[model samples]
Target: MTTSKKRKREIDDTQRVSFALSDQPVTQLGPVLAHFPSIKPTKSTSFKCYKTQTQKPMIDNEDMPFAEIPMLVAGETEAVDFYSSEETRRGSLGSRYFVGVHNKRTGITTLRAAPLHILTHEVKALKGLQPAAVSTLQRLEARAALGETFGTKKAKLAIRAQERNKVDISAMEGVADHLQESILKNTSTLPSKEEAKASADSTRLIPQYDIDALNSSDIYPLHNMIPKPEWKALSISAYMSAGGGAERVALLPFKRSNWINDHLAIAFASPSPNKTAIKMLIYISTMIAFHKATFKDINKEVIQQKLPMVPSVVIDGLLSRFTETARGSIEARRTPEKGTMLLTHMFALCLHVDDFATDTSVLAADLSMEPAKVNMLFKTLGCKVNKLTQSDLKRLGLPDSAGEVKRAILKTPLEFPKPRTRRRA
Candidate 1:
């Protein structure tokens, strides 16, 4: 303790392996590296790690002598990979010349394009022309500068004729139309143009015939009217019988003779021909012809006239049936004062007689009918028979006292009556 004693060096035994005393610890400890007896290490033999690849079939450099490699220029060398990394940029060009003509009257603007040379020349010539013309030229310049490709110079102007107010062969009506015409005319006159046109004319894919000339005469000569082929085909049909058939069956012969005998032979040849109907038709025809000859025309009074043999009621019934069947007349708007009359006949009468006047009462008196009937007839016929309002009269350039305005024209035909239901008892 008295002598200067140095503390034993503190060993860091944390790195050393720890041991635990166990029943079999002795057996496990015998296998440790320290338990093995040390032996002298042997020296490594001097052998190649990898055999050197036998001097790669020695190339004769003397014979090869670096086959003259082309020397790329300084700039060329840089350019090779220089562009490789960068994206190539390009621009698309559009129409070159722009010649727009504005029609002040029609308000239509025509736009056209010309070659660059033609457009430049046009602009130079357009110096002192109309402001519109000058502006159009300027537009062409601007378009060309913007890298637009002008189509062919369609509008050709004479530059030298700018000084003379006289005939500049360029001036024409409808500038755009003239431009197109000029282009067509110039192109058509080129070499081989006539030959090409002749070839085209000879090889027309669709044959064309003059429609008027073709329709002038019947191509086939069956009937004077119908083509021979059509008449022949129809006559040979199974439906056409010698005794009786549809009118289409007799069409071929009917055209030749439409006399009473022809009608009797063809139309009345049906098996169940009604004798009574035939008599009635004969009577009506005789009455109609007699009235036409005597009174010049048949009216309601003429129709009501009784024949010597037939009863008045029979005549009335026949007339009613005839009016309905022949004229397609409707009996509507019947009043006690004015009995039912054929509306179609009344409409024709009114159209012929009435002056688009508001005086419906006067019209009724003249037509020998009630005012209400007159109003209904005019209304059904789509005529504006009512009095015009004050505003309307003024707009029509008529005095307020213009009680009688013109009769309104019929705009549309009368509509048929709707189906009526029977009253339940």
Candidate 2:
């Protein structure tokens, strides 16, 4: 036979392996075939058949080992790529959902897996529609790409309203200045009765009374109406016939008396007097006395040293409690050092008591009386007597000395004193 025809016969008669071979494995099979020339594998081929006959391919699946493969039921089996099916590929990375995304600007495609709760282009992630979410990723990206701020509708409206309602502070100041100038220009003109009444009502002092202690008699009286009894309400003839004019008549039944006496009776049932208030009054009076006596500025520390018995805290608290009135009074009493007046004994004599004797002899006798003489007289009689000087009497708000206590008396009503008369020879 010819050589060509003999080679053709050898190729056609070589033994074939009934197995599928892919492009990758076919190269690996070259050495095996070199060792065993009888193995001639064929390239893998997919058969196209009717859907009814499609079950044969799935029934004969060789890709999965028995341990990895699931149990097959007697029905048209799904052609599942056991390693790379949608379910297997999705579950391979655990439960996270993955989405295919492409960025238009960068022209890059990527598979992004997001958490279960976050919304993405993934159909599995879009479980609910969130209407109240103020911003979306697309809106944010659009703003960023444009390189400008784009506020939400609500924020835009609020900004517009604020701008519209913003007040001009300069204009308000100008208006206030104009109004003040107008008021000053019209100062000579009298206000109308209504305006005056309104001003008075608006500016009326509001008393700061403690509401919890509103029932105190000092704050609110029991009744505002004046009471007149039948006895006092009667005619003069009837009063005279009933012996009302001769002796005291009871205004009301059951030991009727003046309200002052009644109030005093009620006070008798109360606790002891406020010694703190008395001490504060005495300390303040003593400070004033020292200022008059020394003819010096009223220094609190010096006054405190002089009156060591007085409590500093009590006086400070009292001054604070009556700050408005007490401050002005204290400031007035504290005269400047430059024009300070030195009070003389004659001035002190006039200041000692509210009553003044016009007679010089009587005044001289009263002022010159010695307390030791009175005490000696009382000592011989074995009588205890607290002999007090005019200054001590003045401290208790009592009538003291022969003349008048000038500080105790209100100076407004009293006329300037006439020059002291010369004694007749």
Candidate 2 Cα lDDT to native: 0.32
How does residue 339 of candidate 2 score in lDDT? 15
Query: Per-residue lDDT tens digits of candidate 1, residues 1-425?
Result: 49767888776544343332223321121110111022211233111111122345744433321211111111112112111111101111343333355555554555433212100012234346844233344454565544324433432233223324444433553575557668778997876956765554434221121222332111111132222342233212222334553343333321222222333353356676544333322332333332232232335454444333233444454344333323464442223222223332233333322222334564455344677766665554335665666765664455777645434343223222233579999
Show the lowest summed lDDT stretch of 10 residues, model 2. Answer: 27-36
TM-score each candidate. Answer: 0.18, 0.17
For model 1 the TM-score comes to 0.18
- Please give the CA lDDT of all the candidate structures: 0.35, 0.32
Candidate 2: list runs displaced more than 4 Å. Answer: 1-295, 314-425
Q: How many residue-pair clashes does candidate 2 contain? A: 6
Task: Please state the error at residue 331 of candidate 2 in Å.
Answer: 11
Candidate 2 lDDT over 3-96, as tens digits, reads 5545444543224322222223211211100111232223341211111233335644244322223221111112311111233323334443
